[model samples]
Target: MDDGVRNTREWSPPPPASPSLVVRSPRQTVSRLRTRRTHRDWDPSLGRPSFAARDHGPKPSEVYGFVGSITTVIATAVYLAWAYTPEPCLRSLGITYVPSKYWALAVPSFVIVAVALSMVIYIGLNFLATPPPTSFSTMFDENSRERMAFSPAMEEERPIEPILDIGVVQINNLMFGDT
Candidate 1:
């Protein structure tokens, strides 16, 4: 190589990126656009995940306990109504409860049973219903416990603040002369 001629081999620049070259396919481009749109559309006000959306998985113990409680309550009510027919008691008091021969003691007993059963069902449902756990142990156990420990009283107390707008009322009165 001649000393006067500059060495071209060590001084080569990288080729410029072509504007026409497709780095990403059409499907990928569409998917990225859709994802951006979805993120933009989400409302910031909805703070937490819903109960149905949480990934705790199905708890068979809870389901079975609820069903069993309901069944037991119904069976107890039915037994009580059958054992306490008013006809015998009324006869002991020297008064006929139902003079009509058509209306048997069993009719009243069935009605009482149905009413008692309904009450039992309502009670069982209320007692057995468990509110879903607020946080998943794997994702947020430590953070949630720290938050809870910081505000122990807040758990028992109402979290919502009262909306007292005395300033708003004064402004309204100034605008439209107090009626």
Candidate 2:
């Protein structure tokens, strides 16, 4: 009747976090000291809602994105107005301080060509760095490992085998063998 197993496991609080476990910068340390940090350090505390859990308007990232989107839209509108409108129309509007119209085509064209050339250069670098097919790297070099043999009876209890590369002969035999 006395088999040693409990119906429910006892709950234990997690071990205290060591200061040495985390490396913090002096600025971050000062910032942390300056702010009153609040965390739900217990399971039960999470069940109740708090100030941090409430919706606090738009996040900083969302605000930044909104501003960036508006700025981009305004810049594009200005660029289009500058590029398509005739010189006489711009001067009539008292906006004669705009850059040469040639830049509208040249800048975008240069950016496109730069991006394409960078991609080509990256591919060429990779091709140059790759080992030849006939190189010793194709076959596992002197660092190749053999899988340790285990008794058939010990298969269930055996530890996980170390990683070993399958040889070309073994691959061919597995694929093309009559057996």
Query: How displaced is residue 3 in candidate 1, in Å?
Result: 55
Best by lDDT: 2
- Per-residue CA lDDT of model 1 for 1-179, tens digit only, reads 45333222232433646757548789987996776532222223555544643468669999999999999999878556445556677587676544544344676778999999999999999766744455344234333322222366666774654443334445678999796
Show the colliding residue pairs in model 1.
none
Q: How many clashing residue pairs appear in each of the predictions shown? A: 0, 0
lDDT of 2 by residue, 31-118 (tens): 9667744443233433644455455798999999999999999999999998999999999999778899999999999999999999
* Alpha-carbon local distance difference test for all models: 0.59, 0.78
**Candidate 1 — what's its lDDT?**
0.59
* Candidate 1 runs further than 4 Å off: 1-53, 56-58, 87-179
Residue 165's lDDT in candidate 2? 79
Assess the local accuracy of residue 174 in candidate 2 as a C-alpha lDDT between 0 and 100.
93
Residue 46's lDDT in candidate 1: 55
Segments of candidate 2 deviating more than 4 angstroms: 1-55, 141-143, 149-159
